[model samples]
Target chain A: MARMLSGRLPDPPAAVRRGPPWAGAFPSTLHDQRVASLLGIALGITFGTCFLTGLVSHFMQHPPNWLSWPSRPVWLYRVTQGLHVTTGLASVPLLLVKLWTVYPRLWERPPVRSVTHALERLTLVPLIAGSIFQLATGIANIAQWYRFHFFFTVTHYWVA
Target chain B: MSGDGDGDTGARADADAPAPAGAGLSVGGFALRVVLVAAGLAALGYGVDGLLTMPRATRPSNAAAWLIGGIVVHDVLLVPATMLAGFTLSRLVRAPYRAVVQGALIVSGAVALMSLPLWRGYGGSVDNPSVNPLPYGRNLAIVLGAVWAGAALLMIGRAVRARRTGPG
Candidate 1:
């Protein structure tokens, strides 16, 4: 409306053509790609450990017929379970740091430009919600803070 | 559908895209996406089916609330709080001291967060003394004291070294 009144068509910014950045488009060098990528690698290692070890521990407790629960290496369950807790604890820091880094992008303008863009944005719902849920429930469970109504084990498994 | 922690694949994909070879809609890339999406959907369906088998075992409504609450807590509380802290620190701290301060803050914040449940002894009970048996708060203080002390020493060393090799 202002441009129309002024009788001057505003030139489109180059960024208009490419689409929105997943990185927070704000000006800051600290949380750029390098830092994000490094934090990402840290998170990957910690979370990956939690997932694998948690799986082993789960299977040992609720051994299904399809898969064989390991009987040998007497310390197997102990080690896996220990690693699970350790990695999970470590992930608390890594996850929070990573979120802090990329959080600015959450407010990037024109959130979705097309069907594909919208779908991509939609995918973040699960990613964010799932990680947060896992950590919250896991922490609550470990702390024995049984304030929630749902059974932790079953819900945690499905969520995982 | 991505499960990776810090699951911002899009954030990392923006740099130097190999679009000359059609990284997005090339025949191979499209097929890969199709396979990945199919697998993700299948996993989703399987999870839903699995949940149904244990209705009483897992309270659906409450679990859903917790899931949603996690997002709320993160987006509403965590981000804003950190932004405020960062903005305040930027205004207060000088450039030369900023890195040390920031590094110290990050490490300190992470340690405190990871230690909260244990430090509070929320799970400790008369029935189980072994659960968080130690004085976590005191221990945490001791640990943080050491961390900060080390940081202080490092900063002093840097200052001293800089003085000895003055650029001016």
Candidate 2:
């Protein structure tokens, strides 16, 4: 049975055996886990601030029947929106460096086929894509470019 | 992968320990996962609802163009420019003052970006006297000047401390 199986099995392709094209391109200095963790926490805080402030602005614009927005502050909207824009802008640099830090892992070959391995890869899709989407929509909305057919407030709020 | 310290060893041991029969997962982990999933679903629902109820006259193509343009302008142009500035600062600034300089640059960049619309008079409206009434260009300049001045003071303070220490 061992001899019969050996004869039927085909050799693995050269590329599959060799691994990814960027397998050897991971930078030695770019693997600082401490920097990555620090930046990740910072980014998370900035994103949370942006999201919360965005919610406030949304509610102010479209208050529900049970909710009443105050007009006494006068500059309330301006401050919150300014904060949202500033935090969103600050996120640009933080996001870039965070991506740079984990970039090497993008090329890492899975050592074993497992559910955990697949889940790890799947989670990255939302992390990267959602970040880009949020930032892009945010900048455009602030610029008041309404290039899309949908309402900017609705899309931005949901995305946030 | 590199086992460097006792903290890592302790963490590994915790991971290897068997889970409790009634509570297999950590509370923090479970809560975080639940919140993340709910947020995702909420966002998806809102997006779908927005799309379905959008005005017929609204043009989606413009929105798509702006979104794509933003990504290109940021990733292709702004990122590289910031990277170049960072590289220049790292090469020119001494180790003792590098962090201060980098901090100043980041603060200035954020302020400048936030001030762009104001500088361009995008938010100025005669209908509302309270909206963007201040002179943004002058305000931005003052803010940036203060940031640099503060950074200079920090550098001086560091130098004084180093001098007092008489060389490590």
Candidate 3:
């Protein structure tokens, strides 16, 4: 009763309520530059593949007067479209992980101290937003979810 | 920090962090910048062209909403979920076998995400026989079963190795 009345009975033991040493540590260390680099390269390759394939699909669907889409490969559209979706799906995991690895920097102090730093940070707006737009639109297009009134092909082609 | 690193040496040690020592321009760096500029211009030009030429029926507002919605969903939901799973796996599994477990999880997760549409019968089309003709659900099950089996074998191998090497 006396102890309770006092502001504090005694100081809590040091480290008494400490969590496990590795409790907060992510299994894949995000700080590792090598891992980030490798993941970035992989993500880049996947995006490149998706972009090129997407362009092919777009051209095939809306051929220019100068270009002709071959009808011999009846399965061409299916194959390219499948590849586009698959690559985009695969990118979901890669992009998530890549973003996770570099997420620490999002909260780094002195957010923008220099001109170069500001420019660099600004670039992320497009890089990230565009990537998200591409993947999201691609997935929705593949699923044929037309919740949006916009034509999928035209918007997707532009967003690509 | 070395000058001899191969393939895009201009890539900073951490993309979001400060550049490492000795970071400077190289052929790879120049190429990368050029490619990025070209791609950016192309995307912007194409997007603008599409918007200008788009049919009157297409709603720009809808497109904008979808674009923003995708970013929100990914950043808000998917990233955290993935981090939680990774943390949980790390806590549950020993270091020796963690890679196998993580690999299995990633593969299964990707396959599962890709298969959801099929599982929901969204891919089926009565009009076009060529599209989505495969038995997706069954195929997904088979692939997942094989993945788990492989993971099990990997675990067994790690266990045997640990026994031989005496646990670390």
Candidate 4:
């Protein structure tokens, strides 16, 4: 009570009362639920696409420098590979946002009951961890620099 | 009296509503979004062009552009746009977010399968290899059919379940 009377509380800034600089950009009517749903969908598609492409590319040979040989044509492998890396890179931001939105659901309830929830939960561990690994490896591959000794190809293949 | 009881409950409920927070779009966020979108578009264009133009003879240029562009587009445009669109659609429809996400993932899978033909060997002879379009086509068909069928089934199940359960 004394603090309030003494004006110790900070005053509201003008920006707060007048509205922010980019106030109207986002639809005013939109709610958090909508945003979360969109994020989930976006992440789902991006991850799925990247995962499938990466898996396919895994079966192909790494070009020019890698030892051994591939049965498929090297050029074809490169293009698909390029696609896989590109899609994965683009998904970074979306993945981050999706994580944010679905965070609430993690605490809200279990995915389902019994085996269904168990299966879904089981996928979550590898899917999340493997996805980060894939993205990191993909970026490293693009930079034309590799440092890991575990053989990224084998790990990537199994994870995907 | 009953009138007094109603008044007390109404006052308590009003107090429970969340106080508005200042999460409306800010200048910095807007600017960031624009930059991201632009960067994505530019990268996509460069990558696609490189893919189309650079020949078997000059391997380095095409490979560089393709790699860089792919990274840019995926990180900036494709992912973000998908997220926003999916979220908005889900909210408007009031559907299960996971199911919607599953639908989107299935579609992306199909697209990836279609582009599989492009993933063959590079840098040797300029000659295009014989691609058996059948496998790719088949894979795409399977992905699409599964996603659509699953989504439809899920929606129907939800409706029936909701009816049986009545309002929560």
Candidate 5:
């Protein structure tokens, strides 16, 4: 009765009482979910294009036994490759800005809240590693930087 | 992640409260989460399998190094450095021109980073005119010049508008 009258809520449960260290590092008006969602949507579209276009390039290179890609469109390969490179390029800023917006939350302590949260976070490990792999390798590939021993195309394909 | 490290002291009323126990997962959402994890693991496993089978071509060891290295390079070097630069630079600009300045920086930074490789011309081949044909360094300069020109106009317009509207 006294606590209710005073309008103070009870403390959070023992397991997850502390707030994340980076909760207030950024301004909400500028770096909230709205901003994150906007960048995420853009990344989704560009990365989707890159994915589909990547398949087209792979097929063109390998010439799959299952399906005969049309030769009628002389410019088909050109178009897909152009879109892939451009969209991949576009993703750099979107990825960077998206990171800029939400990277503050990387400091979350007590990293796992529950079993479900832990599982969800586990999935992100491959995701972040894979995406960054693609981005770095792709740029190196275009520049002929050859930073890795693995054949770029082979690794890039499997990862994607 | 209740990123509200600063506390709930009147920052912005009714912003997202820290997610509660269960993290607000509903039954359907929980099912979806299960599916997502399963699919992610499947895909990742497949990728690893492909890397392993083609030992010579893929070189899984080196590839794994690059994969983890990307995360490190981005998390440790790229993201923090870029964010800190932006944060430090933002303090120097006045309010009315802030958006324009930030926008120009982002645009030019992306353009420059994307185009730098081309300007370096390491990949350009004499036999293949298709690759890096033009003078990319000069071209990049022109693009940046135009970008700053547009930014200047935006800043002037924003300042004029701010002056007319009076202080908010």
Candidate 6:
């Protein structure tokens, strides 16, 4: 009998056999990850600070009138406010950079055996949607000098 | 017919990966980064000058002081205290990370609630005349102090717990 060579091969569905354009195309270096990490760190810190300040500002019943040093009439409320607004403005660039750095990974599906992949897919919605809403509403709030309709205010309040 | 032992298609698959013939990092990123640093420095400078030039009567007076106090209490005191307490509780209960973060956020939300009333322009400014600036400032302070006390207690409680449990 003539030797017909046999290397085991399982038939793949035609759709599976045809790879997407991005298949096997990954950055050869960690440059993207590094960019992402740096951007994430900046964003994380700025957002944390702004959020903390906003939280404190929410509860001020009587504005600070320095009791011991009762002479300084500096516009302290205005100053903290400026900080909050500025920090918020700064988040725009950081968010963009972060999204860009992680863009490539979104396409890569999980290998056959892991729940980690499922969880990532699930959380992606809230993380992205919440982030966008927070940033958008924040910018809008600043534009209006922190003024907004009660509905938007309430929604932003909860989302943030 | 040349029967090559190895079927080596040597054309690199990654040739397209590099920046296109003229493409490079986005100019916008560089421009935006410069603007951010400039704005931050400018704000810091203005804040410092305002703080320094503050009036020094028989009783020292500075609006900048109020802002600074607010900033410090919020960032340094309220946040750290809440975080420490939440962290302690998490360790004690073996709570999930999300729960801890949510707790901290909720505390922050309380502060934001207090700040809202003060934001409504009830307080008059030198530029913008107001009928009730005094009440405005007082109102803000009362809310802030109440929240501060609560946060401080939580912080102290966390410390006591930490001492008893030997620090997580």
Ranking of models by lDDT: 5, 1, 3, 2, 4, 6
Model 3, TM vs. native: 0.71
* Candidate 6 wrongly placed segments (more than 4 Å): A1-21, A24-31, A61-76, A111-113, A145-150, B1-168
User: lDDT of candidate 6?
Assistant: 0.43
TM-score of 2: 0.60
Q: Give the TM-score, chain B only, in order for the candidates.
A: 0.78, 0.67, 0.70, 0.45, 0.77, 0.33
Worst 10 residues of 5 chain B by lDDT: B1-10
- Candidate 6 structure quality by residue, lDDT tens digits, A1-160: 0011112234445544433235544332322766666766677667666665554454343346652323345676566667766776677656544554555454433211123223324434333444554555565444343333333333443334
Model 3 misplaced stretches (Cα beyond 4 Å): A1-27, A68-86, B1-42, B45-49, B52-58, B121-138
Candidate order by decreasing TM-score: 1, 5, 3, 2, 6, 4
What is candidate 1's CA lDDT for residue B57?
A: 74
What lDDT does candidate 3 reach at residue A121? Answer: 58
Ranking by DockQ: 1, 5, 2, 3, 4, 6
Write one digit per residue (lDDT tens) for candidate 3, span B1-168: 001012112222225334621235465754565455445445555565666677564466776676667667766887678878888887999887988998898889877865566656674357877655678788999999999999999999988988999956
Question: Candidates' lDDT values, in order?
Answer: 0.67, 0.58, 0.63, 0.45, 0.68, 0.43
Worst 10 residues of 2 chain B by lDDT: B1-10
Candidate 6 chain A, which ten residues in sequence have the lowest lDDT sum? A1-10
Q: Is candidate 2 or candidate 4 better by DockQ?
A: 2
> Per-residue lDDT for B95 in model 3?
87
Candidate 4 residue lDDT tens string, A69-155: 555685866776666667676676555555444433333222322332333344343334434445655555443334333344544
Candidate 6: TM-score, chain B only: 0.33
Comparison by DockQ, 1 against 2, better one: 1
Q: Given candidate 2, what's the lDDT at residue A57?
A: 80
Which candidate comes out best when scored by TM-score?
1
CAPRI accuracy category, model 5: acceptable
RMSD to the hidden true structure, all candidates:
6.7, 9.8, 11.7, 19.2, 8.5, 23.3
Rounded to one decimal, what is candidate 1's iRMSD?
7.3
